[model samples]
Target: MTHQTLPTGSVSPEQAAREQSLVDEVVASFAGAESPRLRELMEALARHVHAFVRETRLTEEEWAAAIEFLTAVGHITDDKRQEFILLSDALGLSMQTITVNNEAVGAATEATVFGPFFVEGAPRIELGGDLAFGAKGQPCWVEGTVTDTEGRPLPGARIEVWEADEDGFYDVQYGDGRTAARAHLFTDDNGAYRFWAVTPTPYPIPHDGPVGQMLQAVGRSPMRASHLHFMVSAEGQRTLVTHIFVAGDDYLTHDSVFGVRDSLVRDFALQPAGTPTPDGRDLGDTEWTRTRFDIVLAPAQTASTS
Candidate 1:
């Protein structure tokens, strides 16, 4: 298509009409998509994107800069480090997408953004076992139960837990094959589960990439709230991906990824150096923290279709 170049400043009626027609042209191009849902999505996406460009009166230089930023995000992504996911998180797109997919169903646990660091095949631990696996941080005793929305216990539910250590670094961030600070365990017949993990601390989302630079440019802090990641799944139940945030984390209100939910926050009670542990494991003179996160899952029919 071709068009006459309009002068800068207010858009005349002719220019606005041309812009709308351009959007219509793009939307029409997707009319023949094989999948009805695909056609709808592409057409809607085209209209919204074109509207944004027209509304912002985006300059050529700005478009070029956006392209460059996305290219950098792609260039830095790999099997382990997902810069694009980071970018989405920083922009709140990840959380928005999660919200759109996971609707609240009764008393079910709310879902949150799935960060880029999750790895498959995390080492399995038995109930009441330790997940630290030598990662450095204050020991935390985490216990919880898995139940359906109706409060019925769901036995043998798989719970995957992962978190950053004292230094705010996930095992994957270390770039070594060694895994720590992450593990999976199954609930007992009563739906009760317990394990030891590092006490979570507030940390920044990984900076030093395009996402980080974008955050800095927008005057936004990359800090995330202190929390432990949990992915719970049971047969015939909708899998829940969420975080249990420490009650008093300073970054709770300003989590860079917008992953916090008031319902998910819980107190991490601190025990004295000589306090007795629930599992009878001796911590010697070291203080420990403990928190519980009883999870309620929706039925499989409530799972996200997207």
Candidate 2:
């Protein structure tokens, strides 16, 4: 007796083309959606996704795995944390998006990504105040002037500052009841601001999620360069979100997220105990590190007039 062979399940060329046509049809229907902004975003996303599928000829198993990964990312998020933001950071998308949105306006201060750690309503302190709150780390003094594009001081500029301890961990990471390493300070009449805090050290990003898994798979470390975060703004100038990186950090050349700019790296000098403070207050018996940084802002017309 002879047996008959059955047809294979794989699609023919014609069938594949028909499948693509269906995708295009569905994407085209989005033009009739009510929200203009949503429609625009969906259209762009659809175009890129369709192109990616076509280029890579992605498999069903790979697509399902991608969905599962994204679902896990969402499941891990809560009120005080965002796993997706961490994912964006590890992928360098966060910094890239910030760069795209914040173009330098005529030599204005550079803007960097605002990481997820900044909590609203940090306690405001006067210029020359101590942000360290007596925390443990090498003492560090940060003094800088906020200025407009023409080199004029911008008085009363609000500056928000935050950094990890010398051990490279933020208060939030250490749980509650800790307020030793963050503060908000306003510029003085001369556009000058000063604060005392612990020197920041290189720290690792959260490495217990999908993003972390990806990093391990690629043999990459998650440590960022030692740096201090700053958000500075004035009434008539553009807001600047940036970091002052410690010079000679091992990770400077290999910052996992590519956030380092040459102009932003600075040297921290060792000052003997009892060194005179900028405000004439003596830091007795406390050897400290000091660094001066000056931020230049662009006028309103040069800032966001674009």
Candidate 3:
């Protein structure tokens, strides 16, 4: 009798049946979930994760190493730094979540990552007030209008803005309990707003932790493109978290967090010292940059009651 050899990685019928049985059992465990959505999510998660393990033929040693890496990620996370967000951003999960949650509505502005550095209760600034608060960098004048999808002005919109200084460091990174380069201001009656912010410079995400190690292992850079962050919200509108990338930034194509969007890129025009400013704030012997970012908000999605 001649024996037929199976191809590489092929399992016999009995073994395949055993593997499938395990997956079924795991998925079945979620049947008792109180929420229908929770049950569905847990079951789907179990199936997909099991499929991944089966497809990869993942070894026990590799699973152990992954658990250890995740442990390190949790250990390094703190109020000042979020290692998990870095990991998600590095893996493109953050962007994927944003895409799933933020369906495009007409010409509404696109949304991006709500980076880990955002802090609550930021100081409120009046229109055209400076946001730098003495942080080091070239001065930039940021102006914009907030309007609805129909181009109607949305007055009283709240805009929260933050960015790393020229040296690629947020105020939170200094460990000195200081707040700079971050502020919140409201739109005026005309839905217009402006502020003095430092010109954003490209900077690396926090990469000293396990996420950084993972990126290094895959030969990836942790550099994010130069951009200013914004979180805009108005009554009866969906809140938007996004960034305005500086046009011509070298890292636009390879932003570590995958947060760059073509629509969000804007020109940061350089002005020679002594050029007349719109509001005329004097900067002796210092050149400045300016950019305009118009924001459009989508109508908030209402829950279906039917």
Candidate 4:
């Protein structure tokens, strides 16, 4: 929209202004929406959206392209693919929503965007069991403890873990629904959990749809940081959805999904081969890395119920 300066009293932008005002009145027509909150939200949404179009003087061609882009986004959504969530992550809206909806739960673990790859009903593994089905990355031993905000151990806490492998591919991406590089486990009496899995590596978000074109048009890369995801829950405490990013990953500062946090970044230390694993897994002198992540959960009512 060109801001043309006209001589004072020369001409009035009556047509454009009237169109914007008419849109507002149409929104006002919905003031009788059954729920007060819904009505309020709808009105606000309409006002801002309308204002944006008026302020930008959006072209009909641009609006038509937007409609086509949105249609492609919807067309690509499915049981295994979530194009909408990917879009939200790309726009940083997911992280913004997380920040706003979560209250100060007295120094509990900070939440991050739950990526589009999470799947339910992952096979349960015993303590110290291996989560890698066929991933070929270097072995990584992840150890963690579940504790309450007050530092009390939470025994039997359900800990679900998933991540992409060294090659930057999650199990679900194969489209076979295979269970690998992901598992669900429970904390022991001492509030500790351990598992054998591949080290996480930087990966590109799926970008073969309209999102890919959108990124190309905006000059943005789709690479995400290397990290392992963990979702911890207990009987009476709030669930913690977080990840541990590789401390020195190049993409950590530029994660496409904007899920990285300073507190969540940690070291994945390399250990000499033949070092015995805590779970008594016989690696037969194989080299492996280790990472320890301690999770703190607040009471269910104090935190966002994710």
User: What TM-score would every model get versus the actual structure?
Assistant: 0.94, 0.88, 0.93, 0.89
Top candidate, metric TM-score = 1
lDDT of 2 by residue, 10-84 (tens): 657776666567566757879898998888777767766765665566789989988998998888888867889
Worst 10 residues of 2 by lDDT: 1-10
Provide the clashing-pair count of each candidate structure.
Answer: 0, 0, 0, 0
Clashing residue pairs in candidate 2 are none
TM-score of 2: 0.88
Tell me the spans in candidate 4 whose CA falls farther than 4 Å from its real position. Answer: 1-20, 304-306
lDDT of each: 0.90, 0.81, 0.90, 0.84
User: What is the alpha-carbon lDDT of model 4 when measured against the actual structure?
Assistant: 0.84
RMSD of each: 3.2, 7.0, 4.7, 4.2
lDDT for 28 (candidate 1): 87
What is candidate 3's lDDT per residue for 137-161, written digit by digit as tens?
A: 9999999999999999999999999
lDDT of 1 by residue, 1-306 (tens): 223233346878888778777877888898789999999788778877876787779889999999999999999998767898888888889999999888889999999988877889999999998988889999999998999999999999999999999999998778777799999999999999999999999998889999899889889999999999999999999989999999989999999999999999999999999999997899999999999999999999987787
Model 3, stretches more than 4 Å misplaced?
1-9, 302-306
Alpha carbon lDDT at 261, candidate 1: 97
Candidate 4 global TM-score: 0.89
Tell me the RMSD of model 3 versus the true structure.
4.7
